[model samples]
Target: MKAMRDVWGQALVDQGAKDPRIVVLDGDLANSTKVDKFAKAHPERFFQMGIAEQNMVGVAAGLASIGQVPWTSTFAVFLTHRAADQIRMLVAQTGANVKLAGSYSGLLIGAVGKTHLDVQDIAIMRAMPDMTVLAPGDNTELLAMMEWANAYDGPVYLRLARDPVPDIFGADYTFEVGKVRVLREGAGVALVTTGTQLSRVVEAADLLATAGLNPTLVHVPSIKPLDADGLRAAVGGHDLVVTVEEHSVLGGLGGLVAETLTATGPAARIERIGLADTWGESADNAYMLNKHGLSPERIRDRVLTVANQVLASHVG
Candidate 1:
């Protein structure tokens, strides 16, 4: 399995070399964000903006104004919160073609503590107009999203995890924006997931299948500008719909799927499995995930419980 850093860095290098207008701006974390690969290949197209995320955003906005596709790199916490004002005023307000690559999103930055963790970024960015938020589940999806964002015209935010996740899509898989991938198909229940949480969903689906229940698995990579039609179709007539995410349940994939299903007028029960609205300190990603009931076992239990509830509701 390829790491997210490899996919992100390689995509930047590939796109930067192809398009002369594509430029990279690093907030002194190019090495972590994996933009160093691009810097090495095309020095003139890469700019080091030190540790000032605000200045880096403004610089990217300026470059965007001049018809350059500026991809900014930094930790998710700093990129979304520390430079929020600049992102709002410059990128969202102006509708510039700026790409924001926020690496180490969620509690994936182990041992960095709450100060570095970015759990609220989805809620913040989703509220901003003209911002397309994306969280790829694995390396193949990340590569496809990077290609899409480079050609996409407008403000875009790509959230990537540092640690390697299991590969879900095949090498020949193609990704479309605002479209979800269904790995497993079932009728009793459906699992809607985004980011690294998808790996757990896959495992949970297997367990559910072994228990004589087939659970549908949906992978929603794009958080903002959700694919409501596709979601409704995938979840149509299902007894229960469960949303899983590695981020907060309030405004992440869980909330988005819930809203869409409700609007679609589905009588199916909606369940969310994700991080609560709380901060996390320095700890292992796996431990943090398990603490918040994000593990495959937790997901399986929740889905089974919801499935039971759905049957009860129907029987009544």
Candidate 2:
């Protein structure tokens, strides 16, 4: 089972208990998304928007207008694309206190096929004005993100991974919005990762450490309104930077980091380790991950290769 689903459900319940004004809106996927737990507790505040995701956003926006913090839950693809107009007009444009919970982001929604996988939600949401896009690296981060979103005053998009990901950040780790946390420090190569790929990066770091090579591991949970300064600091001492993520290399965290480096005048060698330019069909999660080069072994190999490149440059 997905640990993130349980963490999000618990967080929602906790938020609802603290604030009676908290409401949940589901698009006929309450049970699957784990928002049904909140609905069971607060039936009066929960709204079943049916399969109409567009109307779900509208309902969330209206609820937000009335001092209610509404959470809209659905698969990432449907939530971002189906409700694009309502999100842009009612949520982003008006700056509503609505939280869009996009479950099963990237190809993690495997077995559901190409139509369900949402590799482009981040790129789409980040383009919206006044929208805060957050992708938690694990269950711990997801819970912390929920706490942050509840206290925040604007529209937010919370992308969730469906896999049973590793618990990276400890229970006591504090999550600050728009801040990147460096898991390791290294002078050779930096591995920047976000979302589900963070666990793989952690494994890669361990693999490199065992080989007498240290690779900096940076976790970026927030995508939009990113902490460019923090990313720069993490990448400063590294001879090369390698970005790893579950999403596509285009318009994702890797692309954002590249854009940041370009503007900040860091001309260091950079590599993007993410899904290549391709669409996926229906498949299991493991098969989908390996097909896209997102497996832990692949990440370890990529990091080692990048380290070798740095060594060669120094030797020459």
Candidate 3:
């Protein structure tokens, strides 16, 4: 297992060897965002913009104007909150080929508290016109997305976590943009999740199976340009569709799934598992996750209950 940020930084360093137009702009958080490796390997292509996240976006915009694929690296909160206006105007509106990497996503910033952690970045980035949103579940998926982002056009937001995550994809994994990967096969229900939340939900599937729920595990890596066909197939005809994310229930994967499914009703009932319309707090990562009902045991229990209720409804 490796941190997705580390995988991304390494991807930049490796890809930079071949792609000269790839430039890395950091908001004085190279080490935290794991772009330090790229800085060391390709100093000529790395720009350090100290804590000025907005200026960093402008600089990246300028680079993009010249056809350079400039990737701005910073915390998810700062990139979305601090430089949103600049990103919206200079990057998204202009259709600049700028890649924005929002590291340390979700409510897992360790002790950084609500101010540092980003609980709604997915919603914010997804709202931007012409913006492509992606959240890779593990090292393999992160590497694939970085490679794709380096070549894709327009504004792209890559959400990543700072913590080490389990390996969900193997060596031969190929990532398709806007496509969701079905991780396991089962019956009756689909347990959908994305990002680092994948491993836990994979476990939750097992727990559900032990309880005779027979859940189909789903990993929705691409939150925007969603895999509509894949999503429909996953949720179609199923009694329940459980969407889990490290983000809020308002406008993350849950919202996207709900919107897409409802548009093509009669859709399956959705059970969204994510943060509420609430801010984060200063606490240990485990404590915060448990408090927010994101722990594996909590997720398992929640899925189990939902499965039972659905079964009972059918019986009735």
| Candidate whose lDDT is highest | 3
Write down the lDDT that model 2 would get. Answer: 0.85
Looking at model 1, residue 20 earns an lDDT score of 95
Q: Residue 275, candidate 1: how far off, in angstroms?
A: 1.1
CA displacement after TM-score superposition, residue 75 of candidate 2 (Å): 0.5
TM-score versus the correct structure, for each prediction: 0.96, 0.95, 0.97
Better of 1 and 3 by lDDT: 3
- Report the lDDT tens digits of candidate 2 across residue range 189-305: 888988878887788788778877778889888888788988888898677889988877888888899998888675588899877867766888778777777787777777777
What does candidate 3's lDDT look like per residue over 1-316, in tens digits? 7777777888899999999999999999898888999999999999999999999999999999988989999999999999999999999999999999999999888686668989899999999989999988888888888888887888899998988899878899988988878888777888888888998788777877787778888888888878798788876778889898889999998999888889865787789988878887889988987877788878888877887898898899
Number of clashes recorded per candidate: 0, 0, 0
**CA lDDT scores, all candidates in order:** 0.86, 0.85, 0.87
Candidate 2: give the clashing pairs. Answer: none
lDDT accuracy of residue 173 in candidate 3: 95
C-alpha RMSD values across all candidates: 1.4, 1.5, 1.2
Q: What is the lDDT of residue 154 in candidate 2?
A: 96
Ranking by lDDT: 3, 1, 2
